[model samples]
Target: MSAQHPRPGITHDNRFFWEGLAQHKLLIQRCTSCHRLQHPPAPMCPGCHCFEMEAIEASGRGTVHSFVVAHHPPIPPFEYPNVIVLVELEEGTRLVSRLVGTPPDEVAIGMAVAVEFEQVADDFVLHRFRSAASR
Candidate 1:
């Protein structure tokens, strides 16, 4: 881990999500009652206010619903003009992650994407999006 690279602070509600990434599997929280799938794990479902959630392995497949090309304020561990995307999973949940394996200019709304993990620290992993057709 780079000394300047900040790490994610995990908590009970989101621990499973982080743990699942270590195994190279993308996990999202599913509401046991409403069946609503959500990301950034939470204790209660916003749709139905259900207090129970289950960790479900995502297909790691999604489509870019929105995105931005960030070029300012260069930061460590990230390239300038990064393609940040909002991926809408096939399961109907959405997550914001960096887009890779495709040029920043080529990134478009509705582009197909899939999950890929990058280990930023010994115990931390960042889930990023890549062009599904790249591999």
Candidate 2:
């Protein structure tokens, strides 16, 4: 691990998400009963209140719905001026991630984005988003 980076904890429910990052793919959970896509993978369907959920790969396309520029570093390994974005995927699911490859002032609502990963450690990867140059 880089001295400037630290691994984030991965829970059982989110292990698949990290695995997908290692493969450069974006994964999310889909509710079989309601056909709604969810992020931060859940054990049950929030829409239908059912436990029937499936892990699915998303198109990796999305737009920034909202964002905030971090002025305070939470810890030593974290950096200031980071951008926290709420990206709304094409599948209609919103996920919280850091926006990369662009300045905070450049981030805007409806801005196109694609999935990218930052490997913090051998088994720890973080999913971030970048400005999508291609459709």
- In the order shown, the candidates' Cα RMSDs to the true structure are 1.5, 2.4
Score candidate 1 by lDDT: 0.88
Question: Model 2 scores what on Cα lDDT?
Answer: 0.82
Tens digits of per-residue lDDT for model 1 on 10-125?
89899998899998889999999988898878889999999999989999999999999999887876787799999999988999989987888889899899999988777777
Task: List candidate 2 segments past 4 Å from native.
Answer: 1-9
lDDT, candidate 2, at 3: 59
78, model 1: CA deviation in Å? 1.4
RMSD of 1: 1.5
Point out the worst 10-residue segment of candidate 1 by lDDT.
Answer: 1-10
| lDDT of candidates 1 onward, in order | 0.88, 0.82
What's the TM-score of every candidate structure?
A: 0.92, 0.85
- Over 26-66, each residue of candidate 2 has an lDDT whose tens digit, in order, gives 88888888888888887877788988777889887899999
Pull out the clashing pairs in model 2: none
